[model samples]
Every structure is written in C-alpha cells, then in structure tokens.
Target chain A: MPYKYIGRTHSFKGKTLWEIVGNLKNFGVGRLVVRNTVVERYPEPSYYRILKVETLPQPKEESLDNLRKVKVLLEKTFRGVTNPKPVCIESASYKTDYRLIPKDEEQRYCQYKAPVTNEKIFPSTMELPPLMKEVLIREMKIKGEPVVEPVMDIVYNDKKRRIAKEGEKPTIEIKIGLGKPAALSLYKGIKLE
Target chain B: MFALNVISKTLNLPATKSAVNFQILRWRRKPRWVPIAKSKQFRIPQRPVIIEDEQIELKRLFNNYRTQMKSIKRYIVERFVAARAITTDPKDIQRIFDEDFARCNKINDEWNSDIQSKRIEYFENTLEENINLAKESLQKRLELEQFKLEEAEKIVTEQKELSKTFITADNIDEAIERSLANPVDYNFAVDLDGNKFYNKKTL
Candidate 1:
C-alpha cells in the first residue's frame, strides 16, 4: 500500500482548496461533488419510487434488476465528467506469478509450465526522473503551519431518579442478633419531631 | 705358770692372739709359721689443712642467717599484711571477686554498645543504599514506559499515513467529528502545573 498524507481543506475566494501534505502522487486530481438535474416540478417526485426503494424488501432477482437500473442511471449522469477523473476501485484477487496449466502434455515431464513466454507480467519499480525528483523535493520542503483546532464544549445535567416507589415496603425480613448494650443504644439519637 | 696352763687346758680355751689369727685366715690349713712383710704397700699424698679464723666463720654464718632471715621476714610480713589489711574471710573474697566482675562487665557493656552503634550506622547506610537502588530502578521503569509511549505514537502516525490517501477535507472533517463524538470515553484533566492527563487510563 502506498503512503498517503491528508491535509485540511479551507475556503479560499469562495472555492474549497484542499492541501496535500505528504507524497504528491495524485496532486492534479480535483475534489468530488454531487449535482442534481431538474426534470419536472409537480405534486411530488415519484412517491411510489420512494415507497418501493426506501422500504425493506428481500434483494432477489427483481430487486437486483432495479439496483442495476439505478447504477446505470448514476453512470449515465457521471459519464460526462472529464475534469475530475472518475475513480475505479480495483477488486481484490489472488495475484499469481504464473498461470497454471492442467492438461498440457508437457506436464508429465514438467509439473508447472508457463502459458506464454515469461514476459514480465507486472511493471517493475521505477526510479523518479531527475526533473520529477527535483520537483518532489521542492514540494516536500514546504512545511505546513500549525492551525488551531476549535474546542468542543459539552454540558452535563443530573436528572437521575430511583426505580423504586416512594412508599415501597421491604419484602425481606431478617432477625438481627444484637447485644444488650447495642440494643439499648440503637434508638438513642432519634428526635420526637 | 704350771697351775695356769693346767687351767687353760682344763677349760679348753684359745688365747686372744690365736683367736685373732684364726679369724684372719679365710681357709683352714695345717698350722705353719709365716713372717709378715712390713714394707710400705701404699703411698698416701699429704697436704697441710688450713683452718679458718673464728670471726670469718662467724661472719659467714651471719651473712647466711641474714639472707635467710630477710627472706623469712619478707614472707612473714607479706602474710601478716594479707591477713590484716586484706581479709582472708570468704565474704571479703567474694566482694573482691564481685568488684572485679563488675569492672569486667562494665567494660564488656561498653564494647557491646560500641559494636551496637556501629551496627546501627552500617544498617542505616545499607538501607540508604537500597533506597537509592530502588529509586534508580523506578526511574528506569519510567524511562522504559516513556520509550514505549513514543513507539506507540510512531506506529499510530504510520497507520494514519497509510490510510490517508486522496481523502478530501470533508471526509477528514467527518473522521475528526466522529473521533470527537466518542472522545476516547475519557476526560482530559489538567493538573496544577497545566499538564494534561487522561482520567481513565495511565499515559
């Protein structure tokens, strides 16, 4: 995995500019935003569409088809975007150095064989060009000034109440064994009021 | 003479000279007349014996007596003084022994007190040394804890760097807000010196 350094974004001249701090692998890429198109201004925008999509239903064949339609509509809407490159998420798979052959007659002699001439399948690690290295070092030298983060304030109130009722009586009974002196002094501090 | 010879024969007695001759003979033999040689058989060396004067003899006796008397007198005086001044009674002897015993015991007590004081001083010195050792151990433990904290912070920083790629400001702000919402389930308390500490856990 490549290392990434995220920086803060702030509004400058009514435009949100994000600063890239560490490695400049994707420096030219712009920010992503969402936009909507106006088709009609009627009583409601597809109430049945809302009820059908928002409610819970088992995602069987019909639901899968509906999801595909929604994906197609999204792709159609974003297909015209050329300024900010559309990002593609690569799916994970087992990366192998060689392809396996099961029915090759040469497998009796050799257990594994290359499907084709062993041309380098993956690109090798490349060193930065002289011009790019100079630019990278120049950009790395720009230190980011510290920014003060806003403090959050929270207040707490005590609104606790006991679960038992006020006039509740004890259900358990216990016979306490007390000595003579203890029994005489048990109620000595009580007031008549 | 006839009458005396008649008497000696009648009495059958030997004369004195004949008896002496009979006694000198070791073995009896037929009586024979032998003349004895009178020549000097042994020579004797003779020197004149000189006698001491009476006064010198008396002076020698006096000197002997004086030495003997002086020794006896000194012995008697020592015994008499011991009998008079220093009592031969058992109680006085026991009292003297008790005084000597007390003196020895006092000396022994002084030695013991000196040893006890030295032992106390040595014990205090060892205790102080042990305290210093304990303090050094505690200081090392604190330093180790501080090193571990720095290592943990470095790891956390590395992890954050690995996860931060191409993240927009809004996402970062959302993460910050989420982090602030939980706030580590703890309070940040400031001490009297304005140093912050976590109330829920050791830092």
Candidate 2:
C-alpha cells in the first residue's frame, strides 16, 4: 500500500503514527497548531472534495545558496555549545471547501422545524396560551407601558432592605428564579435539533 | 554604456585574464535639485479647498454606462441607415431596441467572463509567488538555527580535545624554556595607549 503522508510521523511499536510534539500535532512532513478555539463543530463526520491541485515554483538557486551559507555559519558558531536537532520548516495551504449538501437534504434539514406535531402548529405563528397570558398580566401588572418602572421599584426596595439590615447587622440574600409558566413554555417543546 | 579594455596579444603573448572588466560610464546626467520659483510658492489660491463625501465611484460607473449606451445608440442608427432598413413604426423601433439590448447584454457577459479569467490567472500567479517567498524565508531561518548548533558543537569538541592534552608540571619548565629560546618579534607594536601600530619595514 502507498503511504499517505500528512505530517511528521514517528514509529511506535510497529506502526508509523503521527507524532504529537508539545501542543503541535505533527505528521511526517507537516504539523499544525490550533490558532483559535473550535468555535464551530460538525455533529457528524464530513468529507471534502478535492477541486484543483497546483505545484508551486521552486525557490531560486541564489536564495537557496544564501540559506546554506546561513546554515553553515550557524553550525560553525554553535557546534560546541549545543546539541544538534532537526529544524522543521512549516507551510500550510488553506483548503476551502464548499459543503456540497444535496438540494433536497438542505430543504429537509437546513430550516427551523417545530417538534413533531399531530396538529398544524407553525412555531412562528404560535401564540401564548390564554391562561398563561392572564396570569402574567395579573402577577406583573403589565399594561404595555414601561417594564422599567417596576424594575426600578424592585431595586429601590432591595436597596432600602439592605440599608435596614446593615443597621440590624443581619444578612439578607435575594435569590432569583424563573417563573413556572415561563420556564415550562421555554423548554416544553424545544429538543435542540 | 561601458568600454571593454582589451590588451594587445603581442604585448602579453596571451590574454592574461579570461574575463575582461568593462568600465561603465555614467550615461544620464546627474539631476540637481532646483528650488521652486519663489513667486509660485507664495501665489494666492483662486479656488477654495472643499472636501465632501459622495458616491464618486458609483457615479463614474453610471457615467461610463451612459456613454456606452449613447455610442450603441449611434451605431445602431448608422447601421440601420447603411442597411437601408428604414422604418418609422413605433413597434418596429421597440423591437430593434429589444434586440440590441439582448446583444449588448451578451457582449457584457462575455467581457465579464474574460475579466474573471484574467483575475483568476493573476490570483494563481500571486499565490505561487507568495508561497515561494515564504518557503525560501523559512528555509533560510532553519538553516541559520542549524548552523548555530553546529558551530556550538565544534567549539565544545575543540575545547574538550584541548583539555585532554593538558601540560604536566614536569613539562611546564621545559615549555617555558622552549618559548623563551624561540621568541618571535611582534609584527605589530602596541604603544602605551593600547592602540596597535603596524611596523613599517624599511628597504
């Protein structure tokens, strides 16, 4: 079988495997280091289709000779001072692949779909249940004007309570929790597809 | 412009140097900086400087299209006259306009495709050039590091070898006598100020 080379590899046991040096994932000829956190991920394995391949032109002889001279100078200068090690030169080409998802597959999955429903319930058009709406209005006295007024009143009362407690040397803790109706509505149908 | 110096074959019996040195003379005259006329430097400006943000590029593109349309219209009129297909009917005029519009659109598409191909060629060339440059630089850096390591190794090996041939106490007296007997004069002399001065040998 022909060897498939990706980067610097080392022999472990009897198999030639990719070498992981420090934080770098090294293949026999190439290595890569993560430049950023994985902001995106695939739920399943994906394949990339090769488009075009190109051979880069070789560097000029003059430049190569200059490199050799620099190498010789460095070797001569540090010969007695340090242990010799291989100096790896890394290069990378960005492989930009357009995910070739089938048209029908895209139409089926790349869209918002409501949880399996027996009745026709478009999530976008779904309205709040009447009972929940009444309860919300009654509990919060929400009349469509300003929600900020009530929020300010809560903060003011909390501050007053803290001041009164400071004089009495008592600790007051405030714990906030989601209301039952809101929590139920939020998580009842969403399956995180 | 260079002049090649040639030695006469009789004078040297043979050409002394295989390669001839060509003396290159300065062709272009040296440019001397001339100060701007004092009158022009202090001239009062007739126009006031104005700066404004405007869609200059979009306006230019539209202007170019308008000019192209005008030229096309003129060409169509001339071609129709030459072909002797004169018609005054509004319907016929509208049909001609429609046909020309399609032809113009086709030409535009061809031009756009040509531009795209040219752009792709330029991009590929640029990519290759950039890769070559980067690879060369990286190789040079790696070589430098390796050279440094090799030099360090050489120094250490030499030092170790020298240490192995340490002078014994028994030979120290003989070594001093040998050095004093075969004393060599210093080629360069240093004065009281610690600066080395080369000795000039007299004929």
Candidate 3:
C-alpha cells in the first residue's frame, strides 16, 4: 500500500452535493440522489428528486478543499413514503454524504414496496392519581351527586400524519400501572413485590 | 519569595506583601482560535474496550430503549394528528365565548356591588366624622371670637373712663390755667430745732 492511515477514519462515503450537482448537465435537475446513511438504516428506498438547483457563491478567502453549500428544491421520499410537497435542502447540502442514483435504476428504486406499520390504539382515558381520585369521590358524595369512576381523557398533540391508524387493532397495549422493565439487570437488587 | 516577586512582576499584579504566595489558577478550556498543540495533532483516541457479554447486554438495552421511544413518539404524533382533525363551527365557538363572558361579567358585577356597598358605608362614616370635626372647630372659633370681643370692649370702657383727664385742643387754655393755679414753693428746709423755712432767701 502507498500509505497507511494513522488518524481516525471518517464514515462518509459519497461526495458533497455541490461536487456531484455542479458537474452535471443543467445542474442535475430531474435527477435522483440518496443519502447513504439513511439507506443503511432502513430497508426501503429513501431519495430526493431534484426539481431546481441554485449554486451559492463561494467566499474569496475560502480554500478549494472547503465544503460549499447549494440550495436545491427536491421531492423527498423517505423509507418509500413520498412527501406530498416539495422541500428545499440548503444547510445539509454542505454535508459530503450524498450519492447520485443512475438513471437506469430509477424504475427499480420505485418498485420497492413501502413498509407498513401496524396501528396503535392508545386508551381513551387514564386514571387520576390515587389521592385525587379519593378526593373527587368524597366531594361527589358530599354534594349528593352520583360518583362514577374518576378517569381523565388522554390528551394528545395535534399532527398531520397520525401514528394511531383508524380501524385497526393496537399492536401494543397501554395499561394503567407501573410499566414492566426490559431486563431484570436494570432493577438489580430492588424488590418488585 | 524571589519566584513570587518575579511572577507578580511578569503578570503585572500587585507585589506580594506577605510570606504566602497566592496564585490564581484558571480552570477553563483553551479559546477556539488557539491551534491544537503539534504533539496532540497526530494522537488518536483509543476506543473503549467492553466485554462481549456486557456489549451484548448494552446493545439489547439500547434497542429496547430505541423501540420504546419510537413507539411513544409515534403515539404522540398520531394523537396530535387526530386532535387537529377535530374542527368546531365558528358560530358555536362564538356562542361558547359569549356564554363564558356573560358568566364572568355576572360574577364581576356581584363583586362590584359588594365593594360598592362597603365604599358607600366608608364614605358616609368619613363624612359624618368630618362634619363633627367641623362643628367642634367652629364652636371653638366662635368662643375665641367672643373672648376677643369681650377683651376689646373692656379696653374701650377703660379708655372712656380716662378720657376726662386727657388734654384736648378745646381744653388746652383751661388745663394750663389750672396747672398754674396749683403751683407750690419747693425751696423750704428744716433746721435742728425743727423750724420750717418757707424760702431760704427770706430766712
């Protein structure tokens, strides 16, 4: 070998976005590019289709080896789920971890099935704290009102894509108690009774 | 002692006056602009070595943690989406707001009425106290005025009694004649035998 590496090696395998897009015809518009790190995590394909490209001006004192950022409009598909809207990729373009997918493999890339996750149904209500439950029952009894089970509805944050799918059995059950530990070593010498 | 003086001089600090040499040590990282030392540039950090059993256990624990975290995150996101889906009519929202405002206003009005009653009673009490104070001061002022008038009248009466003896322009000639008529010899002296001399010249 010509030389052996002495210092810590980097995990980056692809060129910077600018290096690949800058050399292409029409700045590689209508081309597919994928991040290797994302592909390594998921089995399904995750990629970006370039819709527009804008090259940023380089600073006069910057060295040639320094990474340059480029603004690119892209239609992103992550883990085979395509985002309805086009997104702009700017700050992350300087990362030297993007690889261009060839034109011939675009069809094969699209053919990969999107992974489906089972629906999770969380409980509609959770029990009140022990002290609060007792207090509420006492108050209701004093007021001569019918005392029902003291439970509060579980409130959730509002989002566009919900993980709790409709018309499906929940994959995991959420019980109102102390959760079970993953391993007994985590508890160590603690008593569980 | 010699080293302390040198150090103080180099640092431009005040000279140490006592035997004890107190040096301030800075506990902080180097500034970002300062370049790494040449000796440390080529040094590689050693990776931590773990036993195979511990490594496996840690991996299992980490996987379990990640899976649980992912499920919790997904659940929160789904709940958020479902919450956002619920939409209420603007008219219904307005009605609810109106009802809430009316209830608040009623309570506020009741509080205002209670405070107003207390304020009215306080004002009445203060006004009664002020009236009594004014009456007392007026009575004292009237008594003082009466005393002053009585003193002035007495002085006028005394001056009227003494007016008969006072010389005026009209009685100047009569007063002078009376004074001349009443003149007496003041030159007489008494001898050893108690003899009285009417005038020394005559004696």
Model number with the top TM-score: 3
Q: Model 1: which residue pairs collide?
A: none
Error of 3 at B112 (Å): 19
What interface RMSD do all candidates show, one decimal each? Answer: 64.9, 32.7, 7.2
- Predictions ranked by DockQ, top down? 3, 2, 1
Q: How does model 2 score by TM-score?
A: 0.20
Clash list (residue pairs), candidate 3: A157-B80, A158-B80, A159-B80, A159-B81, A162-B78, A163-B78
Against the true structure, what is each candidate's TM-score?
0.19, 0.20, 0.44
> Which residue window of length 10 is worst by lDDT in model 1 chain B?
B16-25
CAPRI rating of model 1: incorrect
**Model 2, span B64-158: residue lDDT tens:** 44543444455446557787875899999999999999999999999999999999999999999999999999999999999999999999999
User: Which regions of candidate 2 fall more than 4 Å away from where they truly are?
Assistant: A1-193, B1-94, B114-133, B159-175, B180-203
Best by DockQ: 3
lDDT of 3 by residue, B1-203 (tens): 77666666776785545325577456898899999899999998786777655666677666545544454456557657996663499897898789999999999999999999999999999999999999999999999999999999999999999998999999999999998998778888999999888868766
What ranking emerges by TM-score with the best candidate at the front? 3, 2, 1
**Candidate 3 local lDDT, residue A175:** 36
Q: DockQ of candidate 2?
A: 0.00
Predicted candidate 1 versus true structure: per-residue lDDT over B1-203, tens digit per residue: 55555556666766632222222335665457754234533433354443435444555456544543444455446657876787789999999989999999999999999999999999999999999999999999999999999999999999989876646776988777877898664578877999877754655
Local accuracy of candidate 1 as per-residue lDDT tens digits, A1-193: 9964333332222111111101122321221212111112122221100001111232366431132111101111132222232232111101111111122432242323334543222111122334534554565566453432211111112224222233543332111121122132334775422
**Candidate 2 chain A, poorest ten consecutive residues by summed lDDT:** A68-77
TM-score of chain B of 2: 0.32
